[model samples]
Target chain A: MLTKRIIPCLDIKDGRTVKGVNFADLRDAGDPIELGARYASQGADELVYLDITATQQDRRTFSALVREIARHLDIPFTVGGGISSINDVAPLLEAGADKVSINSAAVRNPQLIDELAREFGSQMVVLAIDARKSGNQWQVFTNGGTQPTEKKLFSWAKEGQERGAGEILFTSMDHDGMKQGFAIDPIQKLSRLLNIPVIASGGAGRQEDFLSVFKLGEADAALAAGIFHFGQLSLPTLKQYLSKNGVIVR
Target chain B: MKTVIIKYQGGNVQSVAFALERLGASATVTDDADTIRTADRVIFPGVGEAGSTMKYLRERKLDQLIPSLEQPVLGICLGMQLMCRFSEENNTRCMGIFDVDVVKFPAKPLKVPHMGWNSLHNTKDWIGDSLDGKFAYFVHSFFAPLNPCTVAEVTYGRPFSAALRTNNFFAVQFHPEKSGDSGMRILKAFLDQSA
Candidate 1:
């Protein structure tokens, strides 16, 4: 049986991890590769690095960072952010990033998904949709959640599935950074609506949150940043908690 | 050891090369038949569609050369699928190194692609039960149903071949390179002990 994944997402800026992590053993917390390898060693099923830096030089640095991470960490990892073009993807993948997620650029050019799925297999293309609840409907947001798009959550996700995205990493803007719980409703529906795995992100305050997301929300994977970064919740502990509660975790 | 990874139109080829590098064994990624045949061990690694990959292999004459080689050859993911007799993926006809045929997973109850980590059970020859009960990363929609060549088993909807071994040919559906320490051990054992 396929086990649910616990992923620690790191925000990268100019080749360094942007978030302030509080792991005592980590010599350099800002280093993505070190942090990533640390997580992998600690039993993290996978890791995601969101390259927030938009500079051309940063892209080069990010690519190098990805290669270093790949060389060191044996677990699967996905690299995203500022990845807008088909040209931008190959370098990261060649650098040994397992998968690349696209947000704004994919929404701006929907064909990008089709092209990426065509060029690379659908397995490597992750469609990350940032959305917030608006008047009883989940509206898609792009440009780091500052700009709203004309796409709805369910429809756009179905569209992404049709366009050959292997997985859907849906981050709930409404519940983001609130540390309450994951947006279980939409995620449960997303898992049912599409054949691909649905990764529930945001609103992960506690290990119990992961259990709910994997059980109630039916998420194939759960992704979080702040809680894991600040050492509020460790991956091994979280996995133990989830496993104790009957949620299959890797 | 002159280890060579067969290079064709495939992704994850670089990853296998990197994994070998980490194991302190540098492998050459090449399409040259002479290099592949001359190598002590050949790693046939790939991630791609079966029909297209097979087409590329045939075009490059790798289709003919791969099976004919006597050296210990290992196939990973799509490379393993392509080693079979046939594939449901785009109705692809594959190199018949393994007698089994690949079929898509049942699309109900559980998700396709059987993504993420799962334990390997019911082991046999070559690797034997040494890796039994250990977790390995798997990602695939199609699977080669249990056959005589199956050395390891993984159950999703039903039991399927996690690793298969026949003569000098060994193949795995899981990405041992991406399965962390347990995975590295498999690769190390393959390099050190496989004859």
Candidate 2:
């Protein structure tokens, strides 16, 4: 039986790790490499480094930071944000990233997903969808959750799977950083809809939130930022809690 | 000393080389027999269909050359499957280095490709100490059944061989390259083995 994964997401800007309250009011965390090593040692199953800044200068800095983080830990790390083309993925994977995640670029050009899945196996490409509830439907959001998409969540997820996305990292814009809990309804719906593994992100206030996602939402993994960054919950402690709750974790 | 990664139209060699470089070991990626034969340790890392990979290996005469190696050799993922007797994928014949057959998971609601972290139990030899009940990442649709060569086991819808060892040749169905520190420790242990 595969165990549930615990991931720590480090949002990067200007080569430094930062966290925000609902993707606003960015606050510096620490050097990315140092923080990545710390998380790896703390038993984070994987690390996600997303470059929040869209500028060319920050992109270069983010790439440099990825190399530094890759140097410090021997774990699977994913690099996302500002990934526009097939060419964009090569540098990050070359710089020691195990996987490259795409968001806005993938939505704009669904063909890019197939192209990437052909070039690099589907396992190397991760599709990250930021979703927000719109009326009765959960809709896709882009541009750091500031822009909304017309595509329905289920349709986009199905397309992503068909286009060969190895994994789906789903983040609920409404629950992000609030830590009240995960947006279980959307996650359960998407997980049932997609064949690929779904990693639920956002709204993990306590360890039970992770348990809730795995048991109720059927998520393959859970990714948290603020709880991990602010030292409110540690990976080991969370794993222990999940294990006690009858959820297999490692 | 530089490590040589046998490039046979597989996957994860770049990441494996990069991981080694971070661990203070320089690595060379090539399919050249001479380069592989002369390297300190040869890593046969692959990810793809079994028959096709073996076809490529035989085309380059590496199929015969790999088994003759006296140095430590590590096989990852599909590389491990090709090192076995036969694979269920496409009903293909394999290298037969290990006396086991790769079979598809029994049909059910369970996913075909068992993807994610799973614990390795019932171990032996070099892998026994590090991976007993320890989680390692796995992603495969087919698996090699437990046999005399089975070193570690992981349960995913069914219990199967996660690691297998036969003399100087060690193969793991899971990607130790992407399996985090415990995985790195396995790599370091393999590198430290005495040939």
Candidate 3:
């Protein structure tokens, strides 16, 4: 049986992890390689490194970091943030990132999804959508969730799947950084709508939040940044909590 | 022992190389036929559509060159699918090293990609000894069905060959390079195979 995935996201800035990672053995929180290795050892199903700024010069540093991270990790890792074209995706994949995720760029140009899926199989492409609840509907946001788009959440997810996105990562702008819990309504809706796996992002405060997202949200995977970076919760404990709660976690 | 990773367009080669590096073996990634044929162990790793990948291999004549080799050749993911007789993916024919067909996973209740880790069972003395009841990471839509050559098996919606071995040729539908310690041990066992 396929198990639920537990992912720890690392926000990278200037080639360093943004948050101070508090893994027990590692002293350097800025060292993404160390944090990633720690997460893997602690039974993280996968890892995601988001380049916060993704400047022209930072791409080089991010690429280098990806190479070092890949060399150290045996599990799959994904690279996202500012990946707009095949040119941006190639270096990261060449650097050993198992998958490359697209966000604002994919919304700006939906054909980019097709091009990426064609060049490197769909499994290598991840479509991340940032959204917020508006009235009775959810609105898709872009440009680091600062710009609101006319596209709705469910339709865009369907379109992404039609264009061959391997997985859909839904990040709730309202729920992001809230420490309350995930946007259960949106996650459950998307999980029912998309045929591919849906990864619920944002709003994980407690261990029960993980269980809630898995059991209630029906998410194939859950990604958290602060909870993991600040050592609010470790992956092993989280997996154990989920396992004991009737959720099949790896 | 020297290891050569057969590199072609649309394949994830770095993780495989890193996996070997973790086991104290540095691998050389190459597409040259001569380098591949002469290597102690050859690894054919890929992550792409079967038809296009086969075209790339045929353009470089790797199709004919791959099957004629005498060394222990390991095919992974699309590599294993391409090693079979045919693939329903884009309606392409493949190398007939393993007489099996790669078919798409059924839609609806069971997901297509069959992504994530799955346990392997049913043992073959040489390759399956250490891997019995061990989990390995897999990410693929099409799978090779159970056959005479199947050594390790796993089930998603139905039973499928997780690992297949026949003399000098060996292949796995899972990504040993990305499957943590168990995967590394499998790769080590493959490398430990006497040539």
Q: What is the lDDT of candidate 2?
A: 0.85
Off by over 4 Å in 3: A19-29
Candidate 1 CA-lDDT value: 0.88
Q: List DockQ for all candidates.
A: 0.72, 0.49, 0.79
Q: Which parts of model 1 are misplaced by more than 4 Å?
A: A20-29
> Across residues B1-195, which tens digit of lDDT does each residue of candidate 1 receive?
899998876469778888898899999999998999899999998888898988888888999999998989999989999999999999999999899999998878777768899988997776668888889998898999999999999999899999888888999999989999888988887888656
Model 1 clash pairs?
A: B113-B140
* Docking outcome class, model 1: medium
> TM-score for every candidate vs. truth?
0.96, 0.91, 0.96
Residue range A1-250, candidate 3, lDDT tens digits: 6888988888887777774222112222467889889998898888999887798998998899999999999999999999889999999999899999999999999999999999998898899999988998899998888789999999999999999999999999888877899999889989998888899998889999999998999999999988888888988888888989999866
Residue A28 CA displacement from its true place in model 3, Å: 9.7
Which is the better candidate, 2 or 3, if ranked by DockQ?
3
The candidate with the higher DockQ, 1 or 3, is 3
User: What is the per-candidate TM-score for chain B?
Assistant: 0.97, 0.96, 0.97
Q: How many residue pairs of model 1 clash at the backbone?
A: 1
Residue A155 of model 3 has an lDDT of: 97
Candidates 1 and 2 compared by TM-score, better number: 1
Candidate 1 accuracy as TM-score: 0.96
Error (Å) of candidate 2 at residue A248 is 1.0
